[model samples]
Target: MTERQALVVRGGWEGHHPVEATDEFVPHLKEHGYTIRIEDSPAVYADGAYMETVDLIVQCVTMSTIERDELAGLIAAVENGTGLAGWHGGIADSYRSSSDYLHLIGGQFACHPGKAPAERKGEQADNFVPYRVEMLPAAAEHPITQGIGDFDLVTEQYWVLADDYVDVLATTTQAVREWDPWHRPVTSPAIWTRQWGRGRVFVCTPGHDMDVVRDRNVTTIIERGMLWASR
Candidate 1:
């Protein structure tokens, strides 16, 4: 039997609490029989030899900078066959200043246009809001969403600008109201999958906080996604 290994990198903007979020996910990987190694920074990416052994990479780092060499190794690992999976701003909102990283990931966080007025704080968008996720036709048969159904969530409904290659799994259509400035009903991809070289990438834009991930349906789908993406 072959030993399974996974690398979990966590850091970046403090607002998302990367440490807490990664803490919540590590056990899930462990439960699947993976020997997980956790890193608080991307420096681990500098070791090309070490990265080659990883079967999956679960990155929770939000908006943070990565040194050129470090970024190169991480990209190479994934391109060579290491699976990559993450959710929310951690992956989509990561490395805001790096276009190369964004290109590899296939999507960028555009905006959360439907944030509730009461939840909004200063310039930063609100974290909690009631919403419903609609499953996409293409995702109906996908392993990650097989048993999952449309469900409601109390978190930000990320409106992403995805690349043409992404296989959208689910979407959330924000309701429109007269008082809302953005009247047009907005549809955001809630979950998606993409391929990078010989590797697989899976992303879910719903895990804003631990509570959001605690949703039974959300947990099930994300777990299934991790398994589907793993090599």
Candidate 2:
């Protein structure tokens, strides 16, 4: 079989460590017969020449903006049978102003509420807490979730605004932070798949920290997800 072509568009917020995060998965994808292309900017999304032939795009950009034509190019690429797959803020939280981009992704990061630190300094820090990722029984037979049982992970548990159109495979609840009274027991989609024209969209929101992205459970699911989403 010909090697599958994959483009990893990395760069945005340094906090997410896009370079390190994307690097960790490079070898895994290579083992799965993928020839990877790494781009440090979202500008790669605008390259119709490159996007036209890529089998998969694993975006790792967070809280970044895309040019109007670039965003349109990405949309067109996916709609024209180029698969789009990503995790965390890279694919989901990116491009806040682009509804068309969000429409393609099927979800967006609203918040990541964690338990507040016990000790008080002059200022408070982002709560980094633990949560469990639960895979729905219906996804048991799905390619991405097969043999992937529920597991507990410590990271920034994201509360996302998700669309019903995607095939939800896994989820995490919002009961970690007692501070947020309104968000208790609210289940959010952690892993899901959507269709954009002839292409596929795969999303997972577990990799806030590099450690979380390196977790075998997360990496395994992502490996499978990339193959599943590839054209």
Candidate 3:
């Protein structure tokens, strides 16, 4: 049998440490006997034909622009049957100019008012508040989050615009801080999965830095998500 193939596309804003994030996970995929091809640019999306042959795509891109042709190619490839996975802005907040891309990913990054590094000077980071991730009761038994319970961490909590149809696996409650208003605590999706045609889409909102991405639970969840989504 042919070894499972995976494509890792990395680039865009350096603030999120896209390269580091990709580095941390590629080894796990290799351990599972995956043939990995790493792309350092978003231009790889333009190769519709090349994309179709792969089984999974791990994208790590921040805010960037994709040409019309490249965007179309990517769409066709994913819809045809390509598992897509990524954490934080690398996959979620990337290509803001293309609403179609957001629609494909099932969510878009709006704001991360948590603790951001000085590198992301453009982003407004107040206190990188400590918070807990609560697994949704309905999805607690799912493979990706099964046997996983609540955990606390201090990191940038992402406020994303997510689709209602997504199967949300975990969530975090917004804190009522002195700096911000919205006194009513809001529950936001921390990790979720969706189906696009024959493809599976997985999104995790936790990785604001390398440390968070390296967290054992975070890595386990993303690794499982990638394996579960592969064709």
Candidate 4:
């Protein structure tokens, strides 16, 4: 069989360590018969011809901006059967300026609520909380999540604003602590898949750093998601 193509688009916030994070997955892609092409910017999305030849896109960009045409090309590529997959803010929180991009991914990072004032310093790490990622019953049989039981992690638990278009597989719940403003607990999609035209889009929200991404459960889910979403 001809080797499949995978485009790794990585950049944006240094905190996410896009390069190191994406590099860890390169060997996996290669072992699965993919010829990898790595780009440091979302600009590669604008290459319509190259994007068309790609079977999978693994994006690690976080909180970055995308040009109108670049976003358009990405949407077109996925809509035309190219797989799009990412974890954490890489895909879920990327390209905040484009509503169309948000529509394509079907989820956005609202915030990761931190510890109470007295218990925390002013650091991003304050947002790292212990949370359980529960696999939803509806997705228990889904290929990407099958055989994986719910697991716990102490990481940046994201609060996402997602749409109904995504088929949610797993979720994390944020409690209604006294310091928090919300009256009730909030549950966000921890793992989800979106079917866009001929393509598949997958997102997992636990990968805040290398350690989190390396978690056994997270690693397995992401690996499965990449293949499951690929054309």
lDDT of 2 at 112: 81
Taking all chains together, the TM-score of candidate 1 against the true structure is 0.91
lDDT by residue for model 2 over 1-231, one digit each (tens)?
A: 679899999999988889998898889889888899999888888788888989889999998789988998889988998888889988889989989889989999998875664543432134466789999987789988899899998888888998899889999998735555684478999999999998999999988777888798998888888889989
Candidate 3 lDDT for residue 111: 73
Clashes of each: 0, 0, 2, 0
Query: What is the TM-score of candidate 2?
Result: 0.93
lDDT of 4 by residue, 192-229 (tens): 99999999999999999999999999999999999999
Candidate 1: regions farther than 4 A off = 114-127, 179-183
- How should the candidates be ordered by TM-score, best one leading? 4, 2, 3, 1
lDDT, each prediction: 0.84, 0.86, 0.83, 0.94
- Candidate that beats the other on TM-score, 1 or 2, i.e. the better one: 2
Kindly report which residue stretches of model 2 are placed more than 4 angstroms away from their true locations once superposed.
Answer: 117-125, 176-178
- Which residue pairs overlap in candidate 3's backbone? 61-90, 115-128
- Number of the top candidate by TM-score? 4
